[model samples]
Target chain A: MDTLRKTRWLLVMLTLAACKKPTENIKIVIDTDVIKYTALINVTDGQNGSPAPAATTIAITGTAANDIFELSGKKDIKLSSGIVTIGLRPTVAPTTNQPITVTAEINAPGYNRETRQVTFRAETKQQVINIQLTKTGSTAPPVVTPPPPVFNNVSLTFTGRCPNRTDLEIRPSVYVYFKKSDSNAAFQYLGYMDKGNISTNLLEQGGTYDFQIVYGAETYKVSQKIDQTSYNLTLDMPAACNF
Target chain B: MYFRRSIVLLLAILLRCYQVNAQNNNQPPSLLGQKSILLNVGTQGVGAEFAYGVLPNLALRGGLNFIPFKAHNVFKISGFNSTSNLSADFYNVHALADYVPVKTASWFRLVGGFAYFFKAKGDIRVIPSDDYKYGDLVLTEDQIGYVDLNVNWKGLAPYLGVAFANTFPRNKFNVSFDLGTYYLNKPKADITGTGLLEGNSSQTPQFQSNIKDYRWLPIVQINFSYKL
Candidate 1:
């Protein structure tokens, strides 16, 4: 009877021993200093340009319809941490882009969370990732407005010959303007010429334009005006615009 | 021989730890600057790789890497492709992990990882429009502006791929090559910025796609790392 008892104890101990490896425990003993990621409610992610709620929890799902990825060593990932990694299996492919997502909650207690959306980004090989996290209680962030279109600070105005096309190329002159205006009758010399011609500025952020076109002996006038409302003249050039 | 190799690896690890700890010792080193430098070279890449162990049924592996690549991107317009090579450089970084649930002398490794890419710079030039008759026509620099845009700007990109490698003879050096592709965002252009350094952003008068994808550039490289 004693022998039987001893054997049972030995078996129980062996089973326990099999479960633990010194190295395996190292990952779980995370440094308390490890910061957990949290964010406030944010605006739409490249969406309608509006504010949204914070995320609740991020669940890293699997690959896309025709994708593959193995999250192996990532098994030790902590849920509480901002970054939770999954494990990949051997033979699982590799990728240059990390496709992972997280879901967010708009509001919560003591924690401020935010909401965002994930869309199809053109990237290379493998899985689609999604991770949604919840936020603690906090006030929502401000709504974002669609940024006005920006123009090239520097314009490319050059004088070159027409290779094959004819009846074009009227004494090479690059038009540089700040805004467009039909005020030929308004202030005379410095009103505003629509951003109709290429090689000039895109007339950005209500500004004054200094028009100067050095063509032949004719000296066109210069004008100055505040861009209240302006539009880009698609001036419609060939697919091969060589200016 | 296997036993001898194990002893060697154990000693190597001990030596490394000893060296690291010894740096804390103010005492002069007995062996001088004879500290060995071990460079682990492997081709497992940024993804997953599997190795089989006859003695041990299972094993684990993880890899993180970043590689820089230089490419000469040719801009094609209308029907003409530029022969005047305009090149760009970009980088990709990611972490790779592998698992071998099954056991054998040569175990199959399931691999997977994430990829991050840096945008590439491209060159764009505008073909101006001066003459307009029937169809879309290109004219002199006077009539239109040549907007040459190069997508060689830098941006982050990611990727994932897996490969299998077999270790030969106990634990000699092993060689395995990997091929994979990740996402690449067309480098954006700042038309406002100028000068020769501009590399032609103001010239790209038009673009067809908003977020163009240049993800087809395949990555092929080899890996070689020694097991401790």
Candidate 2:
């Protein structure tokens, strides 16, 4: 009995001595947005709301043209799937009297040139620009795609996942698309996702949809059923897309 | 100061009791032999000691003690969404003297000791949970990082307490309780953070200030002894 007691005491002491510090493997993280003013420019065929023709280029012209830049900080902006995000440099701020104004000149090989004015207000940090281009000398009136079927309003919250860094997440600001998971149809534009959140009446309740987003040549996809009115979805992006 | 005054009063009473008992009867068998060993467990940790009777009323002891413990989710900081983990380790080696004055009641004695704690440390880390978000982007674990807070008080400490029961058992077994405190040396603290959290190191001074006055460690322990 005495020896047993002694052994127990020794075991207790050894157990305590082997304890490791809690914070030894812990870490904290923070992310920041340096681009304060952003706008998404989506160009489409006027007839069917389909993607614009290839080799589309966008030009900025105005007093504040020098301050315009792609959301990725590039001065040369191009369209991807009829979409591009442009923003004012972090250093520029628009005021009531000095509201920044710029003109977007979009040109494609088979479509008539189109120009639209883009204005930046101080309070609104994000905006969307939808440009519908008319085909040169086409006689048929523009065709409008039928609206998506709706059951109940649904809100989707998107989170961007980084492939290389498991601990980092991104709230993406990009256009979103959806299609029936079992169908052969191409993905159709749903709406814009602002900072990873969007609410729409397009998702029918009890229907399964495959969601997709194209950024920098990569199209990421996630599938979910619209059983509930809301969903938190994840879109995995490559390491190069981390910003 | 209160502990010192109490110790003086206790010694006086025990000495008076011993003197009276000695005048009425010859000295009984010595309370302990020339050598004895003890195994103890207490609030401070677990330890073993070897004791030698230096006089009929006093004995000298030497021993070592150690404690290791880890606590999870013990800390939370405001304005930061994080999970905190805490751990502590204390180890010491010491020499002490036990003075028994009451001839008839040898179980009660006064103890004073000095210990050198070669390993006394506490650590806390704050890790951001997976739910953490900045704007609309969820951060990866590496980009988010973590912060660590470390404090150490590894040096000499003085201990004082009362030991109840004999230092050496009458037969092969003995049990005793010790109530005392160790005044540890001043503590030095530091903070470090990784990745985006590296900025947390600036709070080290504030943490140090909050813990500057925490230098006293109380001990309540039980010892089992055997005569050698």
Candidate 3:
């Protein structure tokens, strides 16, 4: 009986030690989209579709300009790689008949000043506006090229990876830039990626392209060879997101 | 080894007391052959058990228990008005042994048991309430989405407690109160979300850390037993 009691005591101690944190190594994934009804304004050179100069500035002026905010919920929006996403602040909404309109003015050295009207309609939650510029003196008419073949629709899912903080992730809601992997051409405006998912018909079967997004002044890039209808891509956001 | 020796010494003292009482009193107020089935309800929910006196001052009990409950609007997140639905289901079957050390005061007993919890899960889903606005646009329920937090701790748990009355009926019927705790197994927890809330999954680490030490489940219960 004494031996039996000793064994029971040992068993109780062992049971207490058996408890280990089951979720110790688990990683948490979080989506990045908080603001809805956004428009991605992408500025580029009209002739070659190259990114605008680093000194380029964008100014919003209109009745609804004050209500617009960056996707990160900042009022003072700054362009990264000549791209900035503008959205109606969470407190505002657009109606079909009364669409919200804002004038986006782009100015850069040696480039003709340009202004484009961006409209946010109630029916459309996400949009992309391309603002192409012309040089001050160059009278080169906008090149009219033959339309490319209608490629199959391809969907891409972008997941942000944070190296320092493995638990932090971002389902990026930002403008996407894509270019042919073999071409020296600059990245062109693809579309607005909404919470990691974007579908476009520009990617041909078997074609390879490099996709890029500039967030927090850092350019993150990922490459994929288009083969299937859908692809999952990861963008390294080592700094993660502050907002 | 020292702990084992201390428990042995305590048991020896208790045995000596019982032996002395047996010698002084001829009958010793026998509790043996006392058999009863009890219906219980309290913090651990509702349960039914059959208790039988196996020794002059000891009884054995085995039973099953279950509790299912749900509550709403218990949580909020970051100024977002959320309607939280919390639901928990726990079902267990257990067997326990009671040792009444003092023969004169047999009502007080030390109890130990092993309970096998077949289903123990707590789930909370927080959905943004109606009138959620994103800028000027009111979001539909599907667009705003919901977040679900789930925790499961189901396995064999050890129970230890003290009972305030005889487990078996003293007369035809008797009521008893018990205070105890069960050391539950480690829990598995996860957070998932849909729509705009899908990013809430990243909060799993914080949630895990907050709940890591929640292994002890306290119980305060009332049991009514009837002798056959």
Candidate 4:
């Protein structure tokens, strides 16, 4: 009876030992995003920051093997052993709103290196600076046309004033255009429209030869060359909607 | 010597119980000079069932065979980051003959036979969905929907169940209440996804069934049968 009891105890001990469970291995994954032409610098487990790819290479076309964004100031980053991985993302691609893909690799000295693609997008200014690449699309000063010879010596109480209420000197704009080449060569400067005299000037010796107005933002050129008589010059303001 | 004597005494007591029940439990051997034929009739799923005196120690059980299951009520899924509330309806049915080897007065009845499970799919919710990426939340009143489900048998299951029937002769009619457990291995059940649960149950949107791990279904049974 004693031997039988001893044998049962031995069997129970063996069963308990076999039932001790083992530890399970777990896997971890992390994701993030960035833009082009910019650097995403993340501080390592150490005091220093490291670039996402560890180094910059041009072959980073897609998110396959070795595609990572470059960081200008991160090189001597020291990461700890427990620090599994670090991810970096740029603000946006060079010109478009599409964000660049970031593939992260953590290579510590004595530990196994970890790698994964951190996908994300960066915010970008949607509207482009479509302003003229040059003078072709510039919004600067306008052009003027030479007036025809006023040989008629015609001057009768000439009355005119700059309609522009403000900034008449700095970014001044005129309102008239000559339809023909025989129009006036120079435009008389009537003082400020609001404060200048409105009552007429003393009648000069000759009658006035009316030419097109020249003070607005209109461009004018000689359309016709008739030398004999003082033909009236046509003044046309661009449609109000064009401004 | 001790075990042998105990068995002999137990057998003697059982024989007396059987003889007394045979003489006193059933109808007094009909003076009409006629005997009712003992027939065992069972149902396919749900109805009435009974047992009759066929011989000395055996009885034939028959009735409206009815084996029904509770419709699935609550459906839930735990995703990577969130959990969701879902709903499903399910059912079960059984039809077979029970052979009881013990005497008429024996209280325990062990019976094993065949059963069928019919499942009908209802309606699907979460429409116009091509992808399946959703967070988990409790089921709201708005997320509840109904669809008609049809249950049909894909195969048959041989099952086992037990019934305890007590008899009383008040008006020459036999009535009994059955409390039993039926086992179905794997029956065909059509499950339809409706409301919030519709999008996650299919293969295309997400590769997961709405409800998993409820293979063995336990249910409650109440039966009524009359001897002819």
Candidate 5:
């Protein structure tokens, strides 16, 4: 009887040693986009092609105003650094025959209030509307400057990181803007980034630049030196982490 | 169906053994220089082995085994309706030593061995079952894709078990049972996704951690041996 007990104990120990804890690390990651049809409104000073003044505000009006919302799903639309992304409500969408149209009114101190018609069509999911505002008393023609010099192609891959989720990474698809790091110039329109990758010939070598993107009513910025032909940049986008 | 057929064959062999009378005398049979060939089926699948008695109470055996299986919709994720495909393949070659310590009970033997698994892999792919929609827009299959989880445990593994019945047949043939477990190497796991689900590759580390300890492969086999 004693020998049998000892044998049973040994077997139990061996079994326990061979055993492992159950799976606790497999997590289902579900990512879904709510607002599909979007329009990016960029407000600029008509005289010198700079961003609108700090106090500029945007208001949506017209028949489809009720269906319009900020990319963050808020009814109130405000500009951050003279840019705001607006989208139709998740439950509403435009049809092929009956497209949705709304008027975006921009108000800034000392500059003439400007309004632009924004339209959402069934075939287009994303569109950018540029609105230039002139001073109320100025009748002079708007200044037109030559475009920036084009240089060797520079490739950038942006990775969005979540502050709270270490395991989650985001590949954002949106428009990009950039300016020299040391300059106070308003960000110029770069090309659209498709799934976090973009190649452009606008950046000069040995120059440092700040890249920016606006998504979900929030702005994310990253800076990099342009010594190399390719770079991997990381941006903290807490707004895009709503999974 | 194959597993069912193997069980039926094992039962028929057990019945045949019952009909044959047991040896009346209890003197342990001389096993030196004796050899046999065995065919087996169990949790490890079908296999063939050769056994040689090298000592009075000990024998050495060598063999190979393989199993390939595939199924559909066996794995699922909570709150997500998806169709899944699961496949598993395992193949190994092994050598073992069987030692009988009790002269009075030669029918029971302690078995220890090591096996080198040339191929041990499992894969599961899950795809969204329904037509996915983004807001009010319907998406095509290419716009919304699938996720695959893979794991491999291919390496040398040590085995421990016990065998019941004589190593060699009293007559020309005999049937025996073996129960054992193989301590396989730590598994490596990964995840890959295509299209919109491509970001799921970030979850590979967590998936590897979850399956790191799943290294024990259990075996329960019935062996039919014919003496040479």
Candidate 6:
């Protein structure tokens, strides 16, 4: 009788063990990166260096105009807060000897019309074009400021963070802009950050600054104090979190 | 198909051993003080064990097992024609107690044990098999890149199951079969990529969720024992 009872217990244990299926719920997710070659077009008020008037419009011309589209893959490109990201269509790309070029024309009701040449080279996937518009007839050539004073080289590695997704991190490949934290001066162009890393001598020790990047018609900003030679900074980039 | 055939063969051998042992109705000798060394192979890989009889109906065994395996194109992603390379490494040390309950069926035993897994990890890298094109440009492999999924389950685990034969050798030599499973520690999973696929890190959350419950490692082994 004891042997029979033990057999039954063994069978029950085996049955329970067999009920667990470990791989049944496993799922694999794959995401794609579409827009590879892009250019950021930034337009600002030439007088105070503020964002262009709310009504400013952008148009693409030249032979390659038809091959260009907004970062969102829309052909009807317009400036949002005076910034827009334009890219070559997924079916179009530049070759080593043949670079793709387009003319971006900016227009505002009270500002002079301006056009900038945007080029997409095979070697460089990202570029930034800055356009400053001056009010009609009040012409002093657009302010050309002297180079920033040389300072200690500071390396900033910017990581883009997704607000809703804590596990995801983004290494942004885009142009950066910076301004002194206490100054009202417009954000000045910082060099392009290649895969989240950039080293520049424009920052001074014991100073605080705000860094910004404009993408998909939105501007994301992060602030840091330049007390160290190397720092890792994070920005809330909702636009880059679509994946 | 090979695994199914192996299980069938093992069951046939177990039945033969039972028939031979049942022909003699005399009570089996006490196992106390008996010792044996065993070599085994099965789902958990090859291993060597040392077994000692500690009580009339119980024996204690300690052993080590390890398996390092690699394969290609074993994993697939739907809608993505990619080639995957998979590798797994598992090494562990375990101590178990085998208990016999009924005198008439001394051949049957229940096993309970604990194992410390020193190394348990699996990695798979998926690379695009075709010529990848970005826009109109054909990209090199370095630019197209690959995604790697890694999971590690390295910790203490508890084991339970049954054996179909006696734990100690009956005479000079004997064979036995063990069927069991180990409940491993929760696994940690992550995904990483290079080049254009670098954005795949965003999928780490989903990968972790999918692999959270993968803690069961089953064993089906045959042991060849020699009395020492």
Using all chains and alpha carbons, the TM-scores for the candidates as numbered come to 0.33, 0.50, 0.65, 0.29, 0.64, 0.63
Error of 6 at A180 (Å): 1.4
Worst 10 residues of 4 chain A by lDDT: A23-32
Using Cα atoms, each model's DockQ against the true complex is 0.02, 0.07, 0.12, 0.01, 0.15, 0.13
Candidate 1: CAPRI quality band: incorrect
- Looking at model 2, residue B152 earns an lDDT score of 91
Residue-level lDDT of model 3, residues B45-95, one tens digit each, is 789999888888878899998877666654455434568887777799999
lDDT by residue (tens digit), candidate 4, B127-188: 21123211111223334222222223234445556644322212343323333434333323
State residue A82's C-alpha deviation in candidate 5, in Å.
1.3
List the candidate 3 regions with Cα displacement exceeding 4 Å: A1-20, A144-155, A199-201, A204-206, A216-218, A226-230, A238-240, B1-33, B37-48, B52-119, B123-147, B152-190, B194-196, B200-228
Clashing pairs in 3: A30-B199, A31-B199, A89-B135, A90-B135, A91-B135, A92-B135, A92-B136, A93-B136, A93-B137
Better of 4 and 6 by lDDT: 6
- The parts of candidate 1 lying over 4 Å away from their true place are A1-228, A234-243, B1-73, B79-85, B101-107, B116-158, B167-169, B184-211
In order of DockQ, best first, we have 5, 6, 3, 2, 1, 4
Pitting candidate 2 against candidate 6, the one with the higher DockQ is 6
Q: State each model's C-alpha RMSD to the native.
A: 30.8, 14.4, 9.0, 31.2, 8.5, 8.5
What does candidate 3's lDDT look like per residue over A1-243, in tens digits? Answer: 254433332332222233544334444454546666888887878777777888888888999988887766566666777788888876688998899999999999999999999999999998888788888999987543334456889999998887767644677887788888998877766777877889999888899999988664467899999999999998887534431
Tens digit per residue, CA lDDT, model 4, A1-243: 243333332322122122211101100010001112232222122211221222221122345213232221122222211111112222123324655455545444332344444443345311111010112334444332233333333211112212331101011121221222233333322211111111213212233433332221122222333333333332232211111
Candidate with top TM-score is 3
Name the better of 5 and 6 by DockQ. Answer: 5
lDDT of each: 0.31, 0.72, 0.74, 0.29, 0.79, 0.77
Ranking by TM-score: 3, 5, 6, 2, 1, 4
| Tens digits of per-residue lDDT for model 5, A32-87 | 33467888898888888787888998899998899887765567688887888888
> Chain B alone, model 6: TM-score?
0.96
Residues B1-228, model 2: lDDT tens digits? 554684586567546544554454453547445678898887667899998988888899999998776666657664455787877788999999998878676767899999999998878888876554332334457766788988898999998988876666556665667778788887787788775566556557766665666677777677878888
Model 3 chain B worst lDDT window (10 residues): B19-28
Task: Estimate, for each residue in B65-161, the C-alpha lDDT of model 5 and write its tens digit.
Answer: 9877666776776556689887777799999898988876777789999999999888889898987654334556666678999989899999999
Task: Sort by lDDT, best first.
Answer: 5, 6, 3, 2, 1, 4
